[model samples]
Structure formats: structure tokens, C-alpha cells
Target: MMEIVSSTVEIVIGLLVLIGALFSAFSAFGLLRLPDVYLRAHAATKSTTLGVLCVLSGAFFFFWYFDNYISARLLLGILFVFITAPIAGHLNGRAAYRTDVPLWEQSVQDELEPLLKGKKMKYEEKDMME
Candidate 1:
């Protein structure tokens, strides 16, 4: 019974790690092929977050089962990655936009343009006054 349980846990860990690897690979492909920074950020953050989580979870389970240990570092790393990845991506995209990084040539629309235009105009007026 113990052996059976261990084998099952091992199989699950293997699956989790494999899935994580696949997700990371997809993220890399998106980073390479996506047309613009925004899309690349989306792919990098979302998929890489998921992948790292899956891999860490697998490692957590492996250590717990095999070593009878709980790793706080692994748990903290998971939490940190989950919280920071999307935020970093969003900030990078925003910074790119504010710096006038061009969108993909074929991008259909910019939802932020109208929303930011007023702020931009205000800044321009202020600059002119100065």
C-alpha cells in the first residue's frame, strides 16, 4: 500500500513538472513570435507564472513525500512569483506605452489612447505654460 501511494505521488509529480515545462516552452515561443511588447508581456507573465507554479508545486510535493519535509523557501518563492509576475508585466507594458513604444503594425486598436489622451494633453499644456 505504501509503495503504491509513493508511486502514485511520483507519477503526479512527474505530470506536474512536465506540464510546467510545456507551459514555459510555450511562453518562450510567444516571446519570440509575438508581434509586440504588450502581447509578449502577456505571454511571458501569464504562462511563465503558471509554469513556475506548477514546477514549484511538483518540487514541494516531491520533497514532502520523499524527505518528509516542508520547504518554506519553495512556498515563499511560489507566492512571490505569483504576486510579482503579472504586476511586472503590466508595469513594463505601461512604461513602454508611456515612452511611445509603437504597437504592432497590425494592431487593430489602442484602448488606452483615448483614456490617456486627456492626461497627455494636460501635461502638454502644463509644459507649454512652463
Candidate 2:
């Protein structure tokens, strides 16, 4: 019974690892194929983060079960990735926009465009003051 349970656990861990790898590969493909900075960043961050989370989870389970050692570090890594990935992606997209990176031709609506256009540059404001 114990052996059967152990084998099942191992199989589950293997599946998690396999799924994580597939997500990672898909993320890479997205990065290569996506036309613009924003979409590429989105793909890389979202999918890659999920991949890393799954891989870390599998590692956590494997180490805890087989090595008789619970790894706090792996759990912490998963937490860090989950927390930062979206924020980082957002910052990257904002930076790209501020630098005037063009959006893809098929992009339907840019909510930022109008808002950015309405804002005055500091130089323009200074000239207006004078």
C-alpha cells in the first residue's frame, strides 16, 4: 500500500513538471511570434510565471516527500514569482509606451493614448507660465 501511494505521488509530480515545461515552451514561442513589446511581455510574464509556479510546486512536493526535507526556499520562490510577475509586466509595458513604442497594427483601442495626449510636457508648461 505504501509503495503504491509513493508511486502515485511520483507520477503526479512528474505530470506537474511536464505541464510546467510545456507552459514554459509555449511562453518562449509567444515571445518569438508576438509582434509588439506589450503582447510579448504579457505572454512571457503570465505563462512563464505559471510555469515556474508549477515547477516549484513539483520540486517542493518531491523534496518534501522523497528527501524527507521540506524546502522553504522553493515555496518562497513560488511566492516571489506570483507576487512580482504581473507588476513587472505592467511596468515594462508602461515603460515601452512612454518611450513611444508603437502598438501592433491590429490593436483596437488604446486607453492610454488620449490620456497621454492631454497631459502637457514640463517644457510646455514652463513655456506657458512665461
Candidate 3:
């Protein structure tokens, strides 16, 4: 019975790892094929984050069941990736926008333009006053 349970867990872990690898591959493809920085950032952060999480989770489970151990480093890595990936992506997109990177022609909307425009006007006013 224990052996059967272990085998089942192993199968699930394999599936998780496989799915994570596929997601990471798709993320790489998106980075290569996407037209603009923003879209690439979205793909890089969202899919890769999920992929890393899934792979880490599978590793976590494998250690827990097979070795009777819980790895703090793995847990911390999962938490870190979950927290930072989206923020990094957002910052990358923002940097590109501030530096005047061109958006794709088919982009439907730019939600940041008006908000940033007001900030830009304020900065320009301050500069002129100085």
C-alpha cells in the first residue's frame, strides 16, 4: 500500500514538472515572437512565474515524501519568485515606456499615457521654474 501511494505521488510530481517545463518553453517562445517589450514582459513574468512555481512545488513534494524533509530554501525561492516576478515585469515595461519605446501598432490601448502625462507636465513645470 505504501509503495502504491509513493508511486502515485511520483507520477503526480512528474506531471507537475512536465507542465512547468512546457510553460517555461512557451514563455521563451513568447519572448522571441512577441512584437513589443510590454507583451514580452507580460509573457516573461506570468508564464515563467507559474512555471517556476510548479517546478518548485513538485520538488518540494518530492523531498517531503521521499526524504521526509521540508526544504526552507525551496519554500523561500517559491515565495520570492511569486512576489518579485510581476513587479520586475511592471518595472521593465515602465522603463521602456519612459524611455519612449514604441508600442506595437495593433496595441488596443495605453492605460498609462494620461497618468504619466500629468506627471510629465509637473516635472516640466518644475524644470522651467528652476
What would the per-residue lDDT of candidate 2 be over residues 39-126, giving only the tens digit for each residue?
A: 9999989999999899999999999999999988998999999999989999999999988999999999999987887574765788
Off by over 4 Å in 3: none
lDDT tens digits, residues 39-123, model 3? 9999999999999999999999999999999999999999999999999999999899999999999999999899999999999
Query: How would the candidate models be sorted by lDDT, starting from the highest?
Result: 1, 3, 2
Best by TM-score: 1
Candidate 1 per-residue C-alpha lDDT over 1-130 given as tens digits, one digit per residue, 9 for 90 to 100: 9999989999999999999999999999999999999999999999999999999999999999999999999999999999999999999999999999999999999999999999999999999999
Candidate 1 Cα errors over 4 Å, as ranges: none
Q: Pairs clashing in candidate 2?
A: none
Model 3, C-alpha of 57: deviation from truth (Å): 0.8
Name the Cα RMSD for model 2: 1.8
As a whole number from 0 to 100, the lDDT of residue 55 in candidate 1 is 98
After superposing candidate 2 on the true structure, give the runs of residues whose Cα lies further than 4 Å from its correct spot. 120-123
Report the error of model 1 at residue 65, Å.
Answer: 1.2
N/CA/C clash count, model 3? 0
How well does candidate 1 match the true structure in TM-score terms? Answer: 0.96
